[model samples]
Each structure stands twice: as structure tokens, then as C-alpha cells.
Target: MPPEFVLPNYVLRVFTLFEQFSDRLALVRGERKSTYGELIADVLRIAAGLRDAGIRPGGKVLIMAANCFDAPALQLALHLHGCRALWSAPITSRREIDQFASLADADAFVYDQTTELGRELAQSLAPMTVRTMAELFTDGSPYEISATPVPDSVLQTSGTTGDPKLVHHTQAFYEQILELAGAFVANGFPLLRHYSSSPLWLASGQITSFFNLFTGGVLFLTDTWSPEEFYRVVSTERITSTYVTPPMLYELLDHPSGEDVDCSSLFMLNVGAGPATPARLRQGIARFGPVLRIVYGLSEAVVVTAQPGLTEDSAHPERLASAGTAYGDVRLEIRDDDGKVLEPGQTGEVWVQSNLTFAGYLGKPELTAETLVDGWLRTRDLGYLDADGYLFLVDRVHDMIVTTRRNWAIFCRPIEDVLASHPAVRTAAVIGVPDPVVGEAVHAFVVTRSPVPEADLQQLVTNTLNEMWTPAAIDFVPELPLTRIAKVDKVALRNLYRELHPDQTGHDDAASRAGEAR
Candidate 1:
């Protein structure tokens, strides 16, 4: 017989905090506010329900839901019962949901009744026990916390690939978050009234949600995201911290009521998930005071680097382009293709090692082996560290454009940055399109606040970089396509470009020849 597994001390500590702050408000969803007392009781009741349902300690339970008041308690209950929680958001396509369901191999499926996708998945993923949130919480039993199997989780990536990879994390990940939360409190950071639209299925959401709860702070969960709602909630609730992607931040800045909003209560506005243009960052700084904290991380390693209290450094104006230095016991290094560590200021892939790094990819050993090598996670992001230790990300290895101009490697971020620097350009995205002449030509999509001629934009890039890096073609767009998680969807952009140019022969042969000539 196997020995009994005990819940980690960190989990117990969280339960203890819930008890200590029983009457304190913990979660706010819509008009409903829940106290820690209610949250803890809900967790225990759900755990009892799981046990009554005959799910063993190590059983894998798949969950699909939107961000709601019940989500945090439900996830905690799953972990408390020693079940491997596999969480998926309901926003994905039906086909993608089916794929995720197939990959889950779960012993049971649980979902929120409010979501249409949840109802559809519950019907489709059958033969196994399927229960809605209401069913799971019905008729609570008297259950006590005891030693059980160690809990773990499998989270879906943000769909950077055709098939989203499942990232596996163990109790250690939560323990690290608890430690970080403790540090946050001890350091006298503002008591977070955190507002987040990111659900538990995403790594960003998990950190934001748990980091607040663990510190005995209020967490406001919202299902939808809009600039107007964000402003309303921040002002009304006095939200101290929140997170947003670059695209979302742009919307907030461009909104008509941005100048009128009472955002003085906000202490931290974490911007991450992708690069924000330096020009836009300056705008944010000018408006929000020094509250924008630029975070750089991925699902594999959540919170590797953070530039907190972002300000425009007068001596180093270029620091606006940096993602900041290593964060919280993280070891960051730049490595060449050969795996040799590069000197500071040398461009290469970014590798990170930290307690917060994920365990491995679920059911994909080959990929896990490739991504996690020798205790370090290969970020697959090209960047460099300055002599002062600031990290500057150039591009993703896959996003680089290999031009025919002496087979030069061109990164889209630099070109996008140059275009975004223009006063008229609100946001910009660059992609590499197939070109018979230049091998791969740089094509840009710009969303502008005012009319900007293509010639002027082309000349800006030419002056900022060089003629070789100038876009072969430029398209004016109302907005850029974003992924489910709000990062710029380059794949969709490529498909759009292809749709616009069915011939697929090339974009601007004259421009390509001109660039080659330069």
C-alpha cells in the first residue's frame, strides 16, 4: 500500500488565512460580494462533494468556466481534494474545446452552468461523470481537511501554436506564489483590491487571482473587458492593481473618457503578455503617473522580469524599450544558438530559471525536453541584457524575418516600434510575407489616429532604420486582430494579407528591388 500524501504547508496556510480573515471581503463579481468565511466554506463543501462523487485523490477533473465569484473557491476545492485540476476557458472555438477535452483524459468534467460552451461540452464529453457548478455545490457534507495526495494542475497555454500545449504545474508553483505574496505584504505594498478579467485557465490570470487571495486582499472577477467598464470599476471600487495586454492598454488610452476617469486610486497597472510600444508607454506614463509596471514572462515562467513604477529615465531614454531586470530570485541569461551564454549586450535567446517555472508540458515529453533543458526554461524569445541588467526583447525566434538582402535577419518589433513612434500612428504590427525577390518582405499594418500617407510612413522607417528594413507595403486598418488573450494575432494578420492578395506572388516588386538596391 502507498503511504498517505499530506497537503503542503502552503495550502494549509491559505486555509488558515481564510479563517483569520473570515469576515473580510475576498471576492467581488458583479453586484455580489463574498467574504472569506463564505469562500472557505464553499471550498470545503466542494471538496466534500468531490469525495461523495467517488473521485479518488489522484483523479483528474476537467473544468471549464468563465471568471466568476465561484471560480476561486472551486479551484481551491479541487486542489484541497488532491485532484489534478485541468482548467479550460469557455471562450475558445468548439473545435478547440473538443481538442482540449480529448487531451484532458479527465475522470470527470465540471463546468459553469451559465456558459453555453460549458453546456455543450458537458453534453459532448460524456460517459464520464459531468457536473455543473450548482450540482457540485448542492447539499454540502461535513468534511474535514486531512492528508491526501499532493495536488497539481494542468493549464492550457494562450494558443501561440495551432494546438495549445498543456502546461503542468505542481504544488511548488502555488507555494512560490504564496511566498511572493508574503513578500508583497511584508514590503508594505498597497493592499491589493485586484481587478482581473483573466480567468484561471490562463497563467496570467492564475497569478493575478491567487496572489491577491493569498495576501488576504479583495479580488474582483469580471467576465467581459471594456475600457468604459474598467474605468467605472476602478473608480467605484478603488481598485489598487490590475493587469492588461498592450492592445487593451491602447484602448484604455484612446477611450474618450480616459482623461476624466478617477484613476488616482490605482497603485499598479501591470502591462504584459506582449511588448508595448515605447511611444505608447510614454503616453501611459504621462497619464497614469509612475504606476505602469511592465512585466515580461510566459506560461512556462510566470513573472520572470518586471519594471515596476515605470518612469521615463532622462539619462537613458531608451530604457522605455526594455522589459526590465530579473524578478524575484529569477536567474536570466542570454544564450546563442549553440547554448553558450552570451555577454551582456549580445543578442540571443532568453533562458530563465526560477522557483516559479512550470514543471513540464503534459503528455509531451519531446517538447518538454526541448523547452526545459538542464533546469532552465528556454523562452525562445530573442533578447539581450544591457550592462546595467535591463532586458531588451528583440523578437520571437519564429517571428524574425529572413530577408534576401544578404540573407539578413529582420525583427518585426523594431519596425513596429518605429511606426508606432509616429504621432499619428496609434498602434502598429509587422509581419513577414513571402516575396520572390526579397525572400521574405516586411509588411506593416498601422492603426492611426489621423491620416498618414504611406510614403511618409515608409520614409519614417527608412530614416529610423534603413531602406533595407522599410516595409514593402503598408495597410491602414481600424484595429489589429488580437488573440483570445489579446496579443496581436500575427497568424490572422498573415491570413488577412493572403486574402487581400490572392496571387501570393509578392508585395510591391518595385519596393523589394529598391530595398535590395539600398
Candidate 2:
């Protein structure tokens, strides 16, 4: 059957199917299993408890926990009441938590951590109620929850606007998601048996868990990713569809158990959170068979596009660099500064409109207006769509490094794709620094295959890019720093480099950098 042209309401959601299939297994975490009946009952119990605790319609609740079955149910309860939730975990440092907690101004917070510190901080916070998981479960008749009319533009923006800001979504947002997920399940959505390693608080885990619950699949999760532990889980439980980031995939492929672990049952491997390099994408396709799926999305919206099957193109050979064709009620446009659509081969900001886009930012109205203009959220990313309409990303607009000799973005992805063309260099990121003469000299932070001379890497850069755009120095780093969101934190990188190399000088652009470096 063909998909419907329009979806119903926000309340008609991704988890509605689970209400009937009461006895099936839904989630597996550590040593426990949550049946569909158990999951549903828990949702009602938790929602009732939250309502009793004064959580009402239009309230924001903070859920500080990982991707346990309860976490998803708690989120459902919040949604059922037309309330929003912010997922919390250890990865979300206390500082980030305080920052988001302050921004959300949530009426209450649910602390999942059994640690003393988690309890202490929640207790200390003023004007906000705190409930533990035990409390959330044990208490019945928590409150009088409401189902109100959610606005069409009432979507929250994920961190797509360069800054981690909120944005709005239509009332029919999740219904759009359910379409794709429901389709996948109808066509054989393998129950995930070894998914114990998702980034608990974020959308990757959240979306995967929601899909599992709706499709009658099993979802397992872990606090941290471990190669040995994952093999044990997959072998022991036979997890079929798993969500993994590029780096974690690299870790798994390189793991000793990677070869020994039986992956015949591993049906669907969803890779996103960041763009996968052509080489890595190829490697994944080869090792995992054709079961790889690449999703392109931001926290602000559900997945904008996903290709169930990815293939290598001989002509451009860069098809692997693409995020893939747009999918399910999504619009992709490359627009210039004047809002003019750019021609193919021309670079511009990527703009997307989807039913899944969120309500709006929590506290920052100005930020929300700037991003969600005229119902389109302009992703502050620089990229060009191929003639075939495939999206290819270059860099974050903010992450671009403006220099004297070269006016280009410092994207390690292109370099990684090009370096993967070479035999010696393993992975890399190009950081830019101000120089007295050349203006902005790019420093290549590299992880090498073996000991390679700096001159060789310099030549490689010169060969892959113009001499002007070539990296000035190839500095080997054992490991690059990552943000809580897990992308290479260039903001932190620039600060760290400037602080250490103060004599090197720092400036915004070529002219200012020239004076400073001089």
C-alpha cells in the first residue's frame, strides 16, 4: 500500500502499535527485559506519577537518564501530556545539564542515576521537583495529565543552527517519522538484540528505541560502548538492527571480536549522527554486507533523508561523501545569501523543511526566529547538491577557516576522503592558524598508518588540494578532542591551539590575522 499524503495528529504516534501487542518483548537492558504490556503499564504508571507531582500540560520535564525502557516510556508520558523532555545521562556533564536545565526551565526533573551526587544536586535545585526512578514507578496516580492542541509550528530545534538551540515542529511531526519506521518494520524490521551501546540521552538512541517499541523489536543498551561486551550481547541475544556512529563502527571493525562474532543475523546497520567518509562507508558495506543504512538528520528534526542501500559510484567516486537522497516529507534546497536557489555544483547553505521539525527553542526567541525563518530552518552548513540531488556537506559555516591564501572551510572530511586515497595516513582534521605572511596556514592533525615524514603529508595535501589550500604542518595527535555531541569540537580546538601557541597569534580573518601574526 502507498503511504498517505497527510498524517493525522501528534498524539497518533510511533508507539501506538505497542498498545495492542501487549505480551511481546520490547526492551532489553543489562539483565532485564521489558515486555510490551510491562512497557505500557509503566508508561501509564509513570505518567500518572508525574501528573500527581504537579506535571501538567505545557510543562517541560527533564529526564536525566540513559536509553533504558523507562526512559522512552517517561518521554511518552511527557508527550502524552503535551509536555517536552530533555534526556539526561553521564555524557551530559553536570555543566551541560545545568545549562540545559536552566534553559528549559523545566517544572520537574527525573534523576535516573543511583549515585549520591545525582541525588544531592537534584535536591539542591530550587523551585523544581525531583523524582527518582523508583519514586516515578512506585507512585500511582502521579497527576492529572492533559492532551491539548499542539501547534503546527510548535517544534523544538535540535542543534542544527550552529548553536545548540531549540526550534519548533508541527503537530504532525512524529507521525511522519512513524511512516518511515512503520514501512521498515513492515518489510522485516529485525529485532535489535545487541543494541546495548547507543548514546543514551541523544536522538540516535531515542529514535532507535522508539522504532523498536513500535515495530515489536527488542532494544538493548549500555552506559558505554565496549567491543568485547557488544560481541557477547550480539552472539548471546542475536541483535539484528543496531545504530552505530562512524568512529564506533571503526572501533567494532577493528575489534578482535569483529571477525569472530557472527553477524549473519545483523540485518540493518544504521549509520548517522555524522557523515560517513566514502572509505569508511565502503568498508562498512563490504564487511556488513548491503545491510547498511545512512541517515541524515539533526536534533531539530527527525531524519531528513535515509538511503536503505548505499552504493559506490565510479564517475564522481564521491557519492559516499553524500548524506543520501531526501526522504519522507522532506524538502532539500541549497540557497545563497539572497535566498536564491544555487545551481548544481555551486555551494550554499542547506535548507530543509519537514513535518518532524520541532516546536521552537526553549528560552532564546531571537535565536529561534533567526533559524526558523518563514517555517524553514536554515542549517548553518555549507554544501552543494549533486546534479542527481544527492547532498554533499563541506563544513559547518561557523567551522570555516578564512585565510589570506585560501578562503575555504577547514573540513577534515574532504581531507579524510582524499587521505583515504593515500596509503599512509589513517584519519585527519585540518585546523587553521594565523601566519604573518601566508595569512592562514592549515595545520593537519593526523592519525597515521605508520611513521610518515611531514614532507610526505605536505606533498599529499598539495597533491589533493591546491598548494595555497595545502596544510602547512602535519601534527600527529594520539587522539583528537570531541564534544559531548561527539563531533570534533573545533571551537575547543581553536581555543586550545591559540592558548598553547600564543606566539602564533589569533585573528578572525586574513587582514586581522596578518596584523596579529606580524
Superposed on all Cα atoms, the candidates' RMSDs to the truth, in angstroms, are 3.5, 4.8
On residues 233-343, what C-alpha lDDT tens digit does candidate 2 reach at each position? 777777777777666676676676587777777777788777666766777777778878888887676677787766666786677788878877788899998889999
- In the range 362-441, model 1's lDDT, one tens digit per residue, is 87899999999999999999999999999999998877887879878998898999999999999999988778777788
Stretches of model 1 off by over 4 angstroms after superposition: 1-4, 158-161, 506-518
Q: Score candidate 1 by lDDT.
A: 0.88
**Which candidate's TM-score is highest?**
1
| Candidate 2 wrong stretches, greater than 4 Å | 1-16, 88-90, 115-117, 139-171, 187-196, 406-412, 506-518
Taken over the whole model, the C-alpha lDDT of each candidate is 0.88, 0.66
